[model samples]
Target: MRGLMGRTAICILIILFAATAVAAAQTGDDAVTEGNITEIYSTIDTCDITLTSSSTIEDLVIDVQLVHEDRIIDRETLNVDRINANSRTIKVIRWNVKTSEDGAYKVLVQLLNNEEEIASKEYGFVHGRQVIPEVVIEGTIANSEGVTAVIRPVKATLVDIDYMLVDGTDVIYLAKDEKISIHTTPLTVHKRWNTLLLNNREYTGLVKVRPSDEVNAIVVTDSFSSMDDAKITDVYKDEIGASATIEGGSQVPFDGYVRFTVYDHDGENVVESVIMRSPILLTGDDETVEAIWENRLREGKYRLVIEIIGNDGDVLDIQETMIDVEKSVTISNDITEVVEENNSSPSFLITQAVLVLAAVGFVLRRRNIR
Candidate 1:
């Protein structure tokens, strides 16, 4: 009998709990009221409150008040005529403080229907009369040395600039904590970046400037490509050596070398080869590198291959051409024949001996006569 009584009591409690939840849910769905402050944009001079209403409201008014030291400092009122039923109406109320004082303050935003308060929100702010700077990027130029971003700041501020691909995929470079004191003209910020480290294909440059007082950074983007290149422009060959003219593109600065390889007419046997150091190749500069062969080749037609190699030991370009050697070279057999002919000249030696004998005889005869 006791267990049956307890079971009956438990059933009654379960039914009562379920009925209470249903009543609460129904009350939430049928409630008619003005919505809360959805957004607030506060600056030193003004504060904007964005408010919304769910049900039909008429003769609505928005009150934005600034308070300090538990006292009302300033107030601004805006009137909204009406908001329809079964719909939503949102409005932004801009409140101008008209004060430049620096201190902590409270901002109260209220929505009213004919002097009756419907919804209210309070926000805290520390105003210093500092204007949030408007930053704009004019353009960006890229090269092997780095990327330069032209930016115009409307107000003076300290900012850091970062660069990356337009897709936000990777960071290319960063320049931090640059003070922009001039607001009248555009300034250039350069970040060291080697474009050769990236692909040769086209890419978009992205610059993000973050001011010291702002929470979010401003971004600008531009399209660009890697301008780093080294080309073998011209090649010249002489009797003793060969020289190549190398022109570097405007993006990156580097040092390079020239390698000259001389092969037989068949291009199978390397007859002579040499490697020579090149001058420092700067942006858009032309440098000439020369290589002298260690061994002289026989007079014949040969294949010449010239390679332009960078300081990093990477070959930048290769050029091949045929060279005809027409030098007047004296061989060992001709030298030996000339020596033999000079040694066998008996007539000349006989004339030299006769002249010496005549001189000796005349000297002896003069001595006897004396």
Candidate 2:
């Protein structure tokens, strides 16, 4: 009779647990407890995405994102292991303090239940100031058309300019500082002010310009040609590095530079590089230049990419080649033998004789002077 009573008690407990889970499911009281970043001196940069639930929720995804103004500085999405009923949990994400551009930033944390956003909150706070890139407006020139500012950047960034046309205390604000993102070239940013402003009164101008980190310029060139068709001849290795003879011809005479870049067998990362500049080939000239890599690379397969760049930043020719580098005792022995042969060669003997003669002549001249 005691065994039967024990079995009945177990069944009753299971039913009660099911009923409790059903009731909890009907009342999904889940909320994001904290989405705002906790305030601290700029030393620590951490954001907590905390949530509380009245019932256990499985596989709930939480996405925490922090943005400085419109730019997303950091974002983290996580699938919560599980949240216990009537319990709270917190997930933490690290913030790169470098992204905080010396001012208050807004943060967003959203809790999603089965792909539906159930809870979300936004937070904002101010951070200490930092040295950021800016546009330097040295001076301005004005005419009846518009005003132009002599602008240069203090950092690699983009700058926007606003101008005011003033004619004898008649201040006419033309264009506000319109932010322009640059990613074409790191060359100096100079925009001419020629846009027509309202009111035809001729006026002198003053300008204000601002720089932003989001805007940057990238160096690009179409004239610099990759050595795609370059033929690799006589590729060998000695004490210096991997050496190769690059053979190609150019149809147009150009002032340019040649570069040889080598990558590992994967051809993803550069392992060695060599560049030569000036006195390039003439028109319709077949060119041959020796490219010697100085990096001490281990014995392995490597990919070599050669590029010819014109003075105007254009690619002229490009080619790819594969090589296997090896360091062997036999190679060293062969090199020594070749050196010995070269030292005893007729041309080498003639060079030594000339040097000895020159030294003797110098000594005789000194004796006569004495």
Candidate 3:
């Protein structure tokens, strides 16, 4: 009786194993190929899911759930008519939460075919407070035709920028809806105003930066004057002196001098400095002024900084040029100048001839007396 009972138990266990194998064969080898969850904003989350199948599936249903601390915060269901064999499908899901506090969250997803579970996936994320961007206008630079606003962002942020050039109460130029990404570094944005179109006067520059998450925009205002009417048009240099031609524009008269400063090849040592006073320049007038450094330069390289200074000691324009001295002028030019001076003086020649005749007569008279 004991041997018969043991055989019956063995038969029952074999039958159960056969049933489990048959169920697995019918389900097919479908799987969740990829899945991820990311917090895009403070309260917005996106889930990306990919499903792949080895065999065709009919009436596919995808169930997605967002859970926090064992509680279902949100649930979404997706339906697809069919998925071909040896193919994959992609689905995107988004969830908006009411809180922005830091917390652990999960995206639970399940893929089913005809009420049979085929694949499942879970993605976890920790939501944290989003960083709001902040920026400040460091300064403004003005040129003859344009203005540049220097901005420094405190953090990485997306922002809209606006620039305006104002003349007294009138808006002369305006730029709006300029979008840019700013990092933790200085950024310069330039806008052309063509200050030559307007009279020489003081103008106000305005810059506005608006962050996406902020309600109010940050504003910065600075004053910059239109370029002075006087500008250096031509530069001429030699070993002894540097000369520049100053041209006057249509607006104002220019009464300035040119200051020439000489520096070593590396611009580290000051060699010499001189100033050449220029006549008052009227509109549409150009004049050349030269500054002689006196000390001739050797055969080498040097840097010349020329500044157009007004009568009021205001610098109107500045320029820089590199001078390569090929030949030394001290020996050759000085000797030539001395010979020319002696030859050009008629009085010195006549006096030397008279002294020669007088010496010859004295020698003859002394010999005759002996």
Better of 1 and 3 by TM-score: 1
Using lDDT, give the best candidate's number: 3
What is the C-alpha lDDT profile of model 3 across 126-179, one tens digit per residue?
665454438777887654355677878887777887666665533456666556
- 1-370, model 1: which lDDT tens digit per residue? 9999999999999999999999988766544345556665454444545555566667878788878778787787877676665544433333455555787778888888769877788888776645555677777876554567888878766776665532122233434545555466788886654444443445555566767777645655566654345778998874466788988754445566778998889999988899887776655679888777776656788899998777567887899987776645223465445546677787766665576668668756643442
TM-score of 1: 0.34
**By TM-score: ranked, best first:** 1, 3, 2
lDDT of prediction 3:
0.67
lDDT (tens digit, per residue) of candidate 2 on 128-198: 64545354445554443234445555655556654444333223233555566544333233222333332
CA lDDT of each prediction against the hidden true structure: 0.66, 0.53, 0.67
Which model scores highest in TM-score?
A: 1
lDDT of 1 at 347: 79
RMSD of each: 20.5, 22.3, 22.3
Off by over 4 Å in 3: 1-133, 138-146, 197-200, 212-215, 225-235, 239-370
